[model samples]
Target chain A: MSAVALESVTVHAGGKSIVDGVSLSVQPGEWLSILGPNGAGKTTLLRVLAGTIGFRGEAALRGRRIRRLHRRDVARLVALVPQTPVVPHAMTVAEYVLLGRTPHLSLLAQEGEDDRTIAAAALARLDLEELSGRELGSLSGGELRRAVIARGLAQAAPILLLDEPTAALDIGHQQQVLELVDRLRREEGLTVVAAMHDLTLAAQYGDRIVLVDDGRIVAEGPPAEVLTAERLASLYGAQVRVLFDGTTPVVVPVRT
Target chain B: MTAAREHGLPAVSAPHVGVPWTLVALAVLAGAVLVGLLVGPVPIGIGPIAGSALAHVPFLDAGTQLEAAQEAIVWELRFPRVVLGALVGGMLALSGASYQGVFRNPLADPYLLGVAAGAGFGATLVIAYGPTGVDGFVLPLASFAGGVAAVAAAYLVGRSVGGGRTTATLILAGVTVAAFLTAAQTFVQQQNTESLNEVYTWLLGGLATSGWGDVLTVLPYVAISAAVLLVHRRTLDVLAVGDEEALALGLDVTRVRLLLVGAATLGTAAAVAVSGLIGFVGIVVPHLVRLLVSSSYRVILPLTVVVGAAFLVLADVLARSILSPAELPIGVVTAFVGAPFFALVLRTTRSSA
Candidate 1:
C-alpha cells in the first residue's frame, strides 16, 4: 500500500505557481529523495505534503484525503523538519524536543513521564544527552541540526519529511546524520521523503529519486536511471562529469 | 540503577521544577500586601489594622481595638484600593506576557495594539461631552468600549495587511491607530479646557479614589480573561518556536493567536477602564519575571501575575507617600522606575548579542 499519494497538487503564491500540478506516490517504508537545483519548488512541494501550505488538488495519506484530516491527525501520521527552523534563544534542548509530544497531549495537559521518556530517548539517540540541558542558542550549527532532527524523531510519526537535512554540515557529520536516518528507516519501517541538494549523497541513500525542475517533475526512477550526466547538465546549466565507484554514480563539476 | 549504570546508558536529568520558586514569590507578595496595608498618610496602628483585617477571616479572631474612623480608613479605603491595584497590575502584566508570546516579540505590551490610547480617548469623550451629572460607572463603561473597539480595529487593519503574517505590519497598524486616537483625544481636551484636569487625571492613572464598586466592576472580565490565558500557557511555549513550526506541530496557530489576542485585549480593556492608563506595569513586570524566573510561559505567566501584583502595590504606596499629602500619579511612579529598567534590559540584551 502507498503511504502517500498526491494527484496534481498545485500551490500559488505572489501571482505565480510555486508548485505546479504534480502527481507522485511513495510506497510504504520507502526512501524517496527529491533532487532539484535552487528555485525548483522542492521546499514548496514538501510543505504541501506536510499540510502546512495551502494547495489545490488531492493529497491523500493511506487512502484518506489530507484536506479532510484534522491538523492533529496529520501530525500524528507525518512529521516535517524544516530547512531552517527558528530556535527560541532561551529554550532548552529538552524543552524544545518535548514539544513534539504536543499532538498526543490534550489541550490543557502537561507533559507526563511517558512523554519525557520518549523525548529523552530521542535526544540520546542523537548523541545529545549531555547538551539536553543547554540552551538552543548556545549550540553549534551541527548540534542544532541534530536537535531539530531529534525533535522530528520524537514525534514518532510513520512518515518523515526532511528539507535540506544536511545543508550546513561537514562531510563527516553529513554522512553520520544520513546514516542515522537510513538506519531508522530500516529498523522502524519509516517512510522517508527528503529534498536534497547533494546529488552524490541523494544518489547513495535514496532508494528512488524524483528529479524536479521549474515546479514539475522532470524524471522519476531509481537513482542510477534518473541521475544522468545530460539531465544534470541541463537542469543545473553546468558541465558535470559523472564518475562511478562500484555501482554508485558520483557527480563532480567539470573544470572549464 | 546499578545494572543500568554498568550497562553504560545516559542518565536523564530531572526537569527544572517551579514549586520552590512559586512559594518564594507567594511569600514576597504576602509581605508586599502587609506593607501596603500599613503605610499611608493617616497613620494607623499596624497591630490593630492587621488584627482587624485578619479577624474577618472566619474561624480566626486576631481581635481589633480601633476607632470607627481608623477602621474605615483601613478597611474601607486603603484595603480595597490596594486590592484593586493588585488586580489591575496582575491583569496588565499577564496581558503583556500573552502579547509578547503571541507576537513572538519581547517588546510587545498590553497597550502595543492601542488599547491604552483608545481607552484614553473614550475617557476623554466622557469627560468632555457626557452630562455633567453622569455617574462614575459611565466613564469606565465608555472607556472599556472604546478600548475594545480600538483593538478590534487594529486587529482588522493588521489582518488586512500581510494577513497578519509579519509582526512589523501589525505594529505599524497599531501605531497608526494609536496616533489617530491620541489626536482625537487632544482635540477633545482643547475643546473642553474646563474638563482638562479630569481627563488628565484619568489618563495619568491613579487609585486615589478607588472603592469596592470599581473593583467589582472589572472583576468578572478580568477573571474570565485571565483563566482563558492561563489555560493556553503551553500553547504559547509552542508558539515561541515560530508560526510554521507551531502549525506543523499540530497547533492551529491562527485560531490560537486570535483567541489569545481577544482574551488579553479584553482583560486589558477592563483594566485600563478602571485604572486609567497605568504605564510600564505591563511591559516592565513580564520582562522582569522572565529575567528572574524561567522563560517558559508555565512559569512566566503565573509569576508575572504574582510579582506584578506585589510590584504595583508597592508602586501605589510610593505614589501616595512620595510627596506627602499631595499624591503623585501612579503612572508617573511606574514610568520613573520602568524607563530605567527598560533601558537596562536593552543594553544587556544588546551586549549579550
Candidate 2:
C-alpha cells in the first residue's frame, strides 16, 4: 500500500479554494517533492496531509482514512517540520525535542527513560547532541533549522513532511540538511514529502516532482520531464534556463 | 557513531532545576506554614499548636497544654485561615501558569478572562439587593456562579467574534466582558450607597473571616483543578511549540485548550468565591517560579504550587499581623509586592525578547 494517498482533496478558506482537487500518492520510502510558486497552495496541501486542517476529500495513510484516525494516531504516523516554528526562548533544546514523544505516551504520562533514549538518538542523528543543552533562541539560523528538523526526526514517525525546510539557511547548511534527510530515508525506509522552493535542490533529491499552481497540479513527472525551460517560463513567468548535469535538471534564472 | 556512543543517554535527562530545588521549596513551604501557625496577634508557641495537631491524629498520644481559648484560636481560627490561604494561593498560581501556557501569553492570569469582575458583580448584587441576614455561603455561591458565567460569556463572545481559534480574540473578548461586568458592579455599588462598605470590603479581598467551612468549600475544586492541570503539564509544554506544530505532534489542540481553560476557570472561581478577588498571586507567583526555578511547565506547575502556597500564607501572616487589631486586606499585601515584581518581569521579558 502507498504510504500516503490523497484523493481529490480540496481545502477552502475565506470563500476561496486554497487547495482544489489535489490527488497524489507516495509509496513507502519514496521522496516526493512539491514545487510551487508563492501562494500556489503548497503549504495548504501539506497542511491537509498533516491533518492539521479540514479537507473535503479523502486523505489516507497506509490505506486508513486520515479523517477517521484520531489526532494522536495521525501524529504517530506523520511528523511535520513547519516553515517557521515558534521557538520558546527559554526552553532548552532537549526539552523542545522531547515534545516529539507526545503521541507515543499516554495523555497524562511524562517522558520516561525510553522516550528520552529515543529523543537522544534523534539528537545524535542530527549531530545536535552538543547543542542539546543550549537554548533554541541562542542557535544560529542554520543551527535552528537543524534543531527544528531534529524535532521532526524525534517524532519517530514513518512519514516525514517538511515545509520549506531549506528556507533561510545558507547553501552549505541546506545541502547538509537535505543530505541528512536523504540518508535517514534510505536507512530507516521512511517516506519523505517536502515542499521546496529551490528547484535545483528539489531535482537533486526528489524521486518524483509534482509542480502545482493555483491549487492544481500543473505538472507531475521526473525532474527532467517536468522542469523544461519552456514550462518553467510559462508557469513562473520568468526567463529561466534549464541545464542538465547528467540526468538532474538545474534551474537558473536568466535576465531579460 | 562516536558522538552517539560517547554522549550516552543520560545527558538528555539532565533537568534545568533538579530534586534539590524541590526539597528547598518544600522546606520553604513548611517554614511558612510553621510561621503562619506560630505568629499572630496573640503570641502562641509552636509547641502547643504542634501538640494539638498531633493529638488529633489517630493513635497519637501527644497531649495539648493550651487553654480552651488558645486552642480555639489555633484550631478554629488561625489553622483554617492558613489552610484556606494556601489553597487559594496554590490554585491561583497553578491556574495562572495554565492560562499562560494555553494562551501562549506570559501575562495571562487567572482573572484574565473576567472571573474577578464577574465575582465582584455577583457579590455586589447580593450585598446590595438581597435580603439582609442571609446565609454566609449564599454570597459565596452567588459569586461562584457569577465568575463562571462571566468566563462562559467571554468564551461565547470570543467564539462569535473571532472564532475562538485565535488566542488574541479570546483575550480581547475577556477584556470586553470584564469592562461590562465591572461597570455593572460599579452601578450596583452606586445605587446602594449604604452597602458600600460591605461591597468595598469584599472587593478588597481577605481571608480574615475564614473558618473550617471555608476550607472545605474550596478544597474539592482546588484538588480537582490542580490534578487536571498537573496531568496536562507535559501537554502544556507541547503547546509552547504553537498550535500547528502541536497538532502535528498529535495533540487535540482545541479539546486540550478547552479542558485547561475550564479547569483553571473552575478553580479560580472557587478561590474567588470564598476569598473574594485576590489579585497578583496567579500572575506573580508563576513568573517568580519561572524566574527562580525552571521555565518548563513540567517544573513550573509543581514548584509554583509549593512556592505560591507558601508565598500567600506568608503574605496572610503579614496581612493580619502588621496592623494588629485592624487587619490589612490580604489583597493589599499581594498587590504591593506583586505590582513591582510584575514590572520587573515585564522589563526582563522585554529585554530578553
Per-candidate DockQ versus the true complex? Answer: 0.54, 0.61
lDDT of 2 by residue, B1-353 (tens): 23334667426763434779889989999999899889887888887788888888888888888889999888888889889999999998999899889888787775677877887788789889988977366676677678778878988998899776666677788888999999989988999999999888878889975458888878888899899998889889899999889999999988998899878877887788778788999989899889887789988999889988999999999998898888899999999999999888878877453
Tell me the deviation in Å of residue B303 in model 2: 1.0
Most lDDT-accurate candidate:
2
Instruction: Flag regions of model 1 displaced more than 4 Å.
Output: B1-17, B59-62, B130-141, B152-169, B351-353
In candidate 2, stretches whose alpha carbon ends up further than 4 angstroms from where it belongs are B1-10, B14-17, B129-141, B152-173, B351-353
Q: Give the chain B TM-score achieved by candidate 1.
A: 0.89
Top-DockQ candidate index: 2
In model 2, what is the error at residue B188, expressed in angstroms? 2.0
What is the overall TM-score of model 2 with all chains considered together? 0.95
Report the error of model 2 at residue B143, Å: 3.3
User: Compared with the real two-chain complex, what DockQ does model 2 have?
Assistant: 0.61
The lDDT for every candidate, in the order shown, is: 0.85, 0.87
Chain B only: TM-score of model 2: 0.89
lDDT of 1 at A116: 72
